[model samples]
Target: MDEPVLEVRDLVKHYPVRNGLLRRSTGAVKAVDGVSLTLDRGKTLGLVGESGSGKSTLARVLVGIEKPTSGQVLVDGEDVTRLSQAGRKQLRRDVQMVFQDPYTSLNPRMSVGEIVGEPFAIHGITPAGGRRAAVGELLELVGLDPDHANRYPHQFSGGQRQRVGIARALALRPKILVCDEPVSALDVSVQGQVINLLEDLQEELGLSYLFVAHDLGVVRHIAHDVAVMYLGRIVEQGREAEVYDGAQHPYTQALLSAVPVPDPSVRLVAPSLVEPVETGVSTSSTSGGVGGGAIVLEGDPPSPVDPPSGCPFHTRCWLAPALPEAQPDPIPSYPPTDRPDAGLRLVPAVCETDLPALVPRPEVGSAAAPGDVPAAGPGAASHVVACHFARGLAAPRVEV
Candidate 1:
């Protein structure tokens, strides 16, 4: 198999919280906590989560915008985080970023040409056909008219500004692009156009993308692989089909179930399907955590400054030691010998004591037959999940 374009291992980033007049550090907000994943060359890895789930922080860490607390960010086998100044400059050429807000990301003062060609100037490399020609080429490549390269950023629409951002990122001909919600601010109709544009650019240039976004629908469209993040860690990851269809993690399942179905008739027929999680599961029978219905997550996520001891999700986890009836049958248990923490299998005790590692589960029936499915290797058929009970309660494949 080809080498992965980007690989992150045990990536962690923390910001200190200060106090009083002296501003002494009191606590640290755990942003990107112990994240690890691999992005194969020319593939897109969609990092999805709600706000504060550390999606943006992870993207920043990958592109070298923010230094990691501790971890390895290997770009094509090179540890970029530890690279020296000159090596880091060269690294910038190999990797570029596209931010969420095109309006703010682009400079209002610079013409589209200047914005796109700034990379060449910064790297001290003259464009093949001078700066103007090179800038024009980039503009056209991102689906904008080369003639419009002389226009200011304010002259373009939201989608057009995003196209400019893409043009700028491509100017350096970077092998990897870390896109932080690049289309989040665009109009719904325009979002598809930009997404298609990105897909086209990837195929044409053989670019690998670390696309971060909150929308699963967008991720589903762009990502070849998907990694579901909770708090500050990846709870589930696998090929797009496997993760989206047979979502094992309760969080992943909840996220998928909440996606708005377009069929009006289906919504009318199964109105209960669209209702909040608490509405379905009786509160009396289900005491703690969000109930059985649709996995509606309750309460704000735990403070990152002082996250819950074992599982960060335990406080709001629907599967946590909740109602007696809602308790998972037979209880979920891992071998006492393998992990550092073992034999701690009370409803929330095990989850609270041991931070579950992302591990593969058995594939669902039919969509992938037992013998037909490939073994969990670097290639495919690897649907890694984190929650202890997710395996036994794996949701069936539901095509979007």
Candidate 2:
């Protein structure tokens, strides 16, 4: 953690919205607004969000494919955002991208060898031994046969073509790889293999990854840290467990609710995006948001172009301030916990009124999740969340 391999600060990407016969600009699409994160050297930071949440745009900006409207990208503590063309070339080569959609990413007419070795051709980099040998080494490193490099992209399966893409990304011996939903398109079985390959490579070569995907389950397994993006901004980010298990924001809770649970017997009461929380249910859905526990978020996410004032999630947040102070308490806790182990009671007003800052805190201890995000409170010792109720700062804790 001394010097992060990549640090993206307050990044923003806005696209003008065109309309009418003249095709004039009417508005702008807030793809990414004020996203800041640090990718540690030799670690994976998973970027998970719903589609159109700007995960890909951030990835593109990291690799120099898309310039940010504002903010900076620092590589090795040096600003790459203001670098010239030649400097960008050096930065781009050091940080490669494995694009989404293998079918389209690789040219159908080109042979695997040509696509993988194209970097050498473009950058005028001829390996010591030969270009052919370097390409072969790249293919083998990704678990593909070197001889098959002569075959066209169409001849290989979706997974194989993806491996080719990986080979291409590794062609330049990059220090970091920006993968945009690399496994979403492949079969379920193939997805595991590719994920394993990434892990193995990370261990063997000490590569850093900025992995973008919508699957929280996959993200949980591979990522050391997680950033939860909503609309165009990062609603919550911290250590993987801190954001998921110790979520202080309603949006983060809603996202965790959507991840299907392997078991169905457990039922949880979810929060309503547009309605205030009812009086009896426990606030913290202790059982991980599913089964006997659920935290359903009511209503849809609002448009990003014109986000609500105060809190962007206020419009659909179930923790709305509309409910009277004396309203009936159907669910006392967000994920009402009946067991003694359940930790931290959530404060509704603070969550709905002000946006929750992404602060690392010691996670609430539990059997299923060990040392993950604590249900609440800030600690001087380890990563912990400091919600109003947990830290005795904002909303006072109430008995369920």
Candidate 3:
């Protein structure tokens, strides 16, 4: 493929935690820690994760709304982080954002036309004919009547207001759109309309999208590729069919199992097929050993201020330990030890000490070879994951 339209390398955004009196910096919330991905031209990359998982922060960094604590944001092979003020402004013209909330994102005091035309004014580009005509064209482009351009935000419905937001983002004629949960606030029916509109716009304009949302169903429908984020990092990413159909990471599997199945008759077999590893301790404290085909995570997500050691999700992971007794087949245990009890007690010591790299599992084999795992290079074989146990889970239990 040609060079990606957008590329992120080890992006990190950390917010300082402040305390009383002097208001000195205490610690930092690692909102986005070491995230990387690539978006090809004219394609949508759906970013899905639970709330507080840094999806929005990542989006903000991508569009230059938030500065990264470290790492690079490259647009068409140019490192945006190194760009000057004038150069940055030029970069903004190529990338625009659609915020999550339509009501708050649009200025209620301003007319729809003013809001939509603001970008053109900021860039000092008088439209081909005039501002009004250009704004009217943008309004019509998003399916809103051009006459409604004079109306205030309060006068329009939620869906219509969002359409106005879309119009504004397009005023800059950006090649890449960072849609931060654009359809989440609208009615479910309205969401379908907006998604279809986005699809049409991408086709007509040859635009790329970094669509961030928690809605898996929406992502599945619109995304050509999918990246699953957990604890401020990408756990798994690949083609939509490959990642969804054959998720390797335990976190990915757990997330997929949580997606609601509409049919009552269809049943999942993951929970029943795998035997629970007995630690000889009570499982009641931690969600009863993963119930009903769902890996019920115990406790709230770890605090970003002080995230867990090693694998961030290991604290609540049901498959943290590699006890052969845990499943029908013996899986690989970490620490490179033979004695299962030495490593499989409660928390596997290797998971607590060593961080796993995002490695590509063997294409036709079950085990990942031992070596330095490379980043997802510019190729079709970019199905990379960040877990030691992922190789054992090369095949997913259900069609996510």
Candidate 4:
């Protein structure tokens, strides 16, 4: 495989919420805690999760929009973590971002041309003739008329404005585009058009993408690989098909089951995103389809500041540790010293008491050697899960 365009190793981003004038380091909200992913050159990675799952924060960190509290961010095999302000800015041209709200992302006052060409201006980039011809070409490339370059963002439709945003992102001829919920603000019909534009642009330019969205459908269509995030951590990740078709995590299973079926005859029997159809185009609860339905993890997304001690999800998890006397098969204390795989537990004792490591299940009789845990198959090597009993999860259910 070609070297990855972006590799995030145990990336953690926690925003400290301060109170009082002195600001004595109040607690930190774990926006993105321990996220590790590899995005190959020219390939797309869809990071999907609920509203507060730190998806947006992670994107900000990827492009240097926000700094990560810990972990390393490697772009093209070089660590960008320690780069100075100027260094970060230089890297920004290579890795650009398209924000979620087109209305808000674009400066309403600026003409489309200026908006699209801002990158060039910022980087002291002189496109032979001060960015005019280049801006026109960018507009045309995004499927909008070059003439519209003079218009303000307000003059265009939601979809059209989004096209302008895309044009702006492409001005620097970036190799990687970080899309943060790019289509959630558009009409459902328009979402497809924007998604198609991105696909076309990707193929034409060999661009890599870190597509951040809440929509499963959009992610399914555009992402080469996908990661399912919860709270601040990635619960499951693998090749798109492996994770989408055969989701091994209960959260994943619940998520996939929720996408509403368009067919009226196909009643949503179990708890999926769709319920009985109403006359109006029935849409699910969340802004996008994939973001909807699956039993919402209980409790508001735990405050990133001072997250729960045990497994972050355990506080809301139905399958959680209960009092030993009341518990059935008490949550198994993990990484016992007797087990060779023990040191994996670095969490506070609360998590250590009975925490789940997203380990992979070995094929029956496929253990590396006696007492050696089974090695994950090629496809599922990254398929490693974080849940304690993750290895014992039922084989993912395949729809097709």
Each candidate: RMSD? 6.8, 6.4, 5.5, 7.7
Worst 10 residues of 3 by lDDT: 264-273
For model 2, the superposed segments whose C-alpha errors exceed 4 Å read 20-24, 266-293, 321-357, 360-400
**Which numbered prediction scores highest in lDDT against the true structure?**
3
Whole-model lDDT, candidate 2?
0.72
TM-score quality measure for candidate 2: 0.80
Give a tens-digit lDDT track for model 3, residues 89-191. 9989999999999999999999998999999888999988999999999999999999988899999999999999999999989999999999999999999
Give the Cα lDDT of each candidate: 0.76, 0.72, 0.77, 0.72
lDDT of 2 by residue, 210-324 (tens): 9999888899889988887877777666777655555555566666666666554332213232223453223344433334345555556667777655456655655544455
Better of 3 and 4 by lDDT: 3
Q: Which ten residues in a row have the lowest lDDT in candidate 4?
A: 267-276
Clashing pairs in 3: none
Q: What is candidate 2's CA lDDT for residue 126?
A: 92
Model 1: per-residue lDDT, tens digit, 171-259? Answer: 88999999999999999999999999999999999999999998888998899999989889898898988777667665776676566
Clashing pairs in 4: 28-305, 29-304, 29-305, 30-304, 258-273, 356-388, 358-385, 358-386
Residue range 69-174, candidate 4, lDDT tens digits = 9999999888998899889988988899999999888898899999998989899988966589999889999999998889999999999999998999998888
Superposed Cα deviation of residue 224, candidate 2 (Å): 0.7
lDDT for 237 (candidate 3):
91
Off by over 4 Å in 1: 264-294, 323-347, 363-381
